[model samples]
Target: MADAEMVRRETSFWRHAVVTVPAILLLGLASGWVSNSGYGNPWFDGLAKPQAMPPGWTFGAVWTTLYILLGVALAFILQAPNSGTRRTALILFGSQMMLNFLWSPVFFGMHQPRLALAIIVVMLVLSIATTFWVARIRKAAAWLMVPYMVWLSFASILNYEIIRLNPAS
Candidate 1:
């Protein structure tokens, strides 16, 4: 009986993951594509890139993996019972998602690196909050966000460098 209950719970988590992973991946891909965030954007291509900037393809690869991890994290959170911590995690997660979706447009579409930097910083804070709140609800979910936080740290540095390098831009 215990094994059966465990399998059922595990199935529920998997079911949520199946829905969330693809949804987040599609949204992330769409956001980047719609805003022309990467190599082909004229403004982006002309910007003063940091010396440590990875290859163009690396962005897609890293983001794809990060989004999948985030989606799985969301699924883990979703499978948990309702509580104050869970609600806080959900709110923070949603805030992060909104900021994430807005970032490419703010930077690549509107050509506002400074504003985008602000957004990214707030997003990072919210993501950190989400991870902690998720830790209270689901420990594994918190681990899933580590890669995302690390990537955000790198991206923040890159954004700062772009602004520093192109003071006139």
Candidate 2:
């Protein structure tokens, strides 16, 4: 019985991962593409960038890795037995993702850095809450989310610096 249960749980995790990883990748890529974010965008290219900014290729690479990590974290959470903790984690995760999807549009499509910054701040907070809630159920799941939070912090700094450099923007 124990072995069967373990196998079932493991299968559940993989099944969720198969759905999660690709969805995250697609949604993230689509968000960036729809907004025309990054180097090719004329408005973004014209803005003064922070000195610490990485090359154009770096964003895609780092975000790809981070999104994969986040997807795995989410899969782990989803695989856990349903409960209030899991529900809270899922809520936080969905909320953060919504804001995540909104950021590119608000910043690049709408040209509103301040509002985008606010959205990022809230997203980061929700991500942290999700991490903590996931931690209550699965330590490894929470561990997977750490890099995302770290990257979000760095991205927030970059966003702030961009707004500071181009107050007119």
lDDT string, candidate 1, 1-169, tens digits: 9999899889999999999999999999999989999899999999889999999999999999999999999999999888888888999999999999999999999999999999999999999989989999888899999999999999999999999999977
Query: What lDDT tens digits, residue by residue, belong to model 2 across residues 54-122?
Result: 999999999899889989998998998889999999999999999998999899989899999999999
Alpha-carbon error at 156 in model 2, in Å?
0.6
What does the lDDT read for residue 50 in candidate 2? 99
Taking all chains together, each candidate's TM-score versus the true structure is 0.97, 0.98
Which candidate should be chosen as best, given lDDT against the real structure? 1
Name the runs in model 1 displaced over 4 angstroms: none
Once model 1 is optimally superposed onto the true structure by TM-score, how far is the C-alpha of residue 28 displaced, in angstroms? 0.3
